[model samples]
Target: MKLDFDGIRLQAPFYDETHREWRDSVVRPFIDKEIVPHIEKWEKDGDIPLEVYQRAGEVGLFQTGYSEAYGGVTDGVDIFHALITGEELARPGAGGVAAALTVHSIALPPVINFGSEEMKKKVAPGVIKGTHHISLAITEPSGGSDVGNLKTTAKKDGDHFIINGSKTFITGGLKANWFTTAIRTGGEGIGGISLILIPADAKGVSRSSVGPKQGWICSDTATIYFENVRVPADQIIGKENEGFKIIVNNFNNERIGMAAGAVAYSRVCFEEAASWAKVRKTFGQPLSKHQVIRHKFAEMLRKINSTQAYMDICGWHIKNGTPNAADIAMLKVQATKTMEFCAREAMQIMGGISYVRECKTERIYREVRVMAIGGGSEEIMRDLACRQMEL
Candidate 1:
């Protein structure tokens, strides 16, 4: 029983030949050649080079689920293609690699969906081509999940808006060419917020690194500051005070991608543990021969399979234009919890060997907390789900 990477994936009817060709020909080869080989060095250096993004762009990795007018491949693409791309990216077990390369996934959608035609034309092509980078700046130093209370402000001043305040824990912040930011434009709460695109080179816009983090090491995290930054009023992503709806919509898609990645990471943990259990001797024989160790594998598989099914159902809802935020939120919680459990059990099975760097399980073990907290914390997700349930 030799379990390879693809062998661990649970087969589902949702995927077709397009998804398989994407996995087998495009993403898997790219990960093996580009990401898997250099992940250790990139993780150690705390950054992935921009060239990798350029290459990813060249191969249409960033084109999925996007409009063809903006260099995206949306003719036959759906949510499943995006999910497959995300899952294969996680196969290397370095979440940061996926995080850094795909930061635009969260940043660009608002611009595409609601921005002016000129704004979309200006921003989308370069980013999709991987020649430019963008970051979503919503989480502030004062708050994380509480977007309604964000303190960042952009005051109207003639033809331009004067922006102030700061954002923290922003993925891809350090290298971003533009920030799709949330600012208070009205009064208070969700109604006050609006999304704007701020050029990183704009005067009064500055950033500093927020490392060394516990995990996602290869992805550069940052605290970005805006001191009386000025931008054209037209830079706003949507109508003033209506950005909350855009943000919520973005969150649903982001959570779906995160859920897919989390489940894939869990599978990676299971694979590493199973491989180790077969070879590493204990007592009088291999660890897999022991009942206790065998049970661990069974438990990991049970969780992984269940989470994969939940993710697929959520993806289907999204594809059919009937996404339930509550289910997506719960699915994210389910996937991250599964990743957490699998990483722990894999560590226990591998013993001290799992504690060292360069080991996928060890790296994933460090990343569990971020996965649980980043998209929306487990606490917040549960609360959101319950609110949607009206219970």
Candidate 2:
């Protein structure tokens, strides 16, 4: 049994034959051959080799949901393509690897949508081709998820802006060649913020590993510091002081991808536990024969199916052009909580073996916290949903 809710062939209205073919022929084979075998070493090293991104690019993975002008195949691809990418990537149970490979998803949008033609040509082609690394920098040492209260300041000189601040918990920060960063430019609060692209090698720019994290060990999270980094004035992405709206709109897609990954990860836990239970005999028969174990599987399936359903609905909403921030926010919280539940149950069913590093369940259990916390925390998502509803 595949036992994966996402892979169960639900005939989701959003995904057609092309999407399935891509998932089966391209995404699954790539994960099995490239990711599953070497994930342990990458996790131990705190990063994947740069060539992984290059290989992914060569296979059209990064181009799935982007625009054709900028090296994407968006003529036929839609929101579902992006969702499928996230789901299949999470199948490896290596969220860090997925994050590292797709950091440009969040990082390059501002440039693609709002940057000058020169800026777009300079970065998008290389990024889409998998030869460049780009990441977004918004969370600061002090701000955490409070984008409105960011303290990073950028003072403009004749031809350059002097940046001074630090961002922490930045995924792919150590290896990123360019950063699509948020900084304070006008005054206090969200109205004053602006987005700028800062090269990693700029003078006075420095970064250090955030050190060992609880999960996402394979991701290169870092604490990036800027003392007096000078960025060309034209490097600003979008209009100055109007970047807050961009960030807000960007959160919807980010949360959607996070939710999709969470659901797939839950299914991974289910598959692992189900396979384990079928063979490991207990008192007399297999563990799956036991009532309690069967009940556990039932509960896992319920949550996984519900999450997948919500994910499909949300994808449809996005495709049809709906105001879905509130719905997406709530779905993010729902998906992460479901993932957390499934992971805990899988660990319980597998017993001590789930606690060791050798199993996907073990790595997934460690990774659940980051899923809930990153993109946006569960608490933040709930509050954002309420606020979007004007509650």
Candidate 3:
């Protein structure tokens, strides 16, 4: 029997011809040619080469949902289009490729939405062209999800702000041209936070790799140090002491993209396992013939379909500009949990062979924790959802 992997995707009303074309024609071919062939080498090298980013830019991969003036293809793009991009990027099952290639998605939005024309002119074009790289520096060594309590400080000086602090677990940090950074410029807590654009080559800016990680090895995580790094005061992305709201708003898109990727990764796991089971024999016949293995496929498909539906509704709400932070938060948790379950079951079904790097399930199994913990920990997501529900 043939296993229909595409049939696993829900027939959601939100996806039209454009979405399908973008997935099937644009992103899918790109991943098949540019990414899939080199995932193992890149993973072993601990970082993806800069050429991949330039190639992605040449194909308009980085331009979706961005402004036309800055080389973004906005006329036909919507939230679902962006989500489709995320889903396609996850197809190779090397989460590091997706994370490293798309780090600009998290970093550039604040600049586009809240930055001055000068800032936009300086930052957006080169990044969209894939000639330059940028990273969002929000997760400090002292905290991850606790954005309000971050300890990075920026003291005002003549015509500049003296930034003196650090950020950890920063994706693409080592090669970034600029950092859309969160710095403390006021008193304390959330009220004191502000966003700033700091050139990575500035006088006191330095970084070291936070590598040998459990996963995302090709993404090049870093622990950045700022020792009295003096950046012009006007480099602030938005008004001082009002950055918390911007940060909160940014999480909605990030979480949505992550959710799309997570659900897609879950589907990848299901597809890999099912393909393996159909051929791998056990007691008397193929593993796919076993009642127990068939049940595993059933459970995996059930969760994958449900999560895709949830993601679609959330995407619709976001496209209509009525995004609920709570629902987006919860959807992230749901997608990651679904990924965890599918990965575990897929590994079990594949048995010892699944433990090797040759299979996508092995890499996906290693990546489940990062998906659950990176955007927001499952515990933090649940608590945030409940708090937003006013429970």
Cα lDDT, all candidates: 0.93, 0.88, 0.92
lDDT over C-alpha atoms for residue 359 of model 1:
86
Per-residue lDDT of model 1, residues 283-302, tens digit only: 98999999999999889889
lDDT of 1: 0.93
* Candidate order (lDDT): 1, 3, 2
Task: Please identify which of the two predictions, 1 or 2, would achieve the higher TM-score against the true structure.
Answer: 1
lDDT of 3 by residue, 1-391 (tens): 3454565777889999999999888888888899999999998899899999999899889999889999898998899999999998988899999999999999999999999999999999999999999999999998898999999999999889999999999999999999999999998899999999999999999999985998898899999999999999999999998898898899899999999999999988999998899999999899999999999999998998888999999999998989999999999999999999999999999999999989988988899999999978899999999998889
TM-scores of the candidates in the order shown: 0.99, 0.97, 0.98
Who is ahead in lDDT, 2 or 3?
Answer: 3
Which is the better candidate, 2 or 3, if ranked by TM-score? Answer: 3
lDDT of 2 at 348: 92
Q: Candidate 2 on 1-391: residue-level lDDT in tens?
A: 4665554424566789888888888888988888889998998888899898899898888987667888988787788888888988998888888888878999888889899999988889889989998999999999678999999899999989999999988989999989999999899998999999999999999999989988888889999999999999999999989989998888888889999899888888998998899898999999999999999988988887788888889889888888488889999998999899999999999998898888888988888989998988999999998997899
Give the TM-score (vs. native) of candidate 3.
0.98
lDDT agreement of model 2 with the native: 0.88
Q: Which stretches of candidate 2 lie over 4 Å from their true place?
A: 1-10
For each candidate, C-alpha RMSD in Å?
Answer: 0.9, 1.4, 1.1
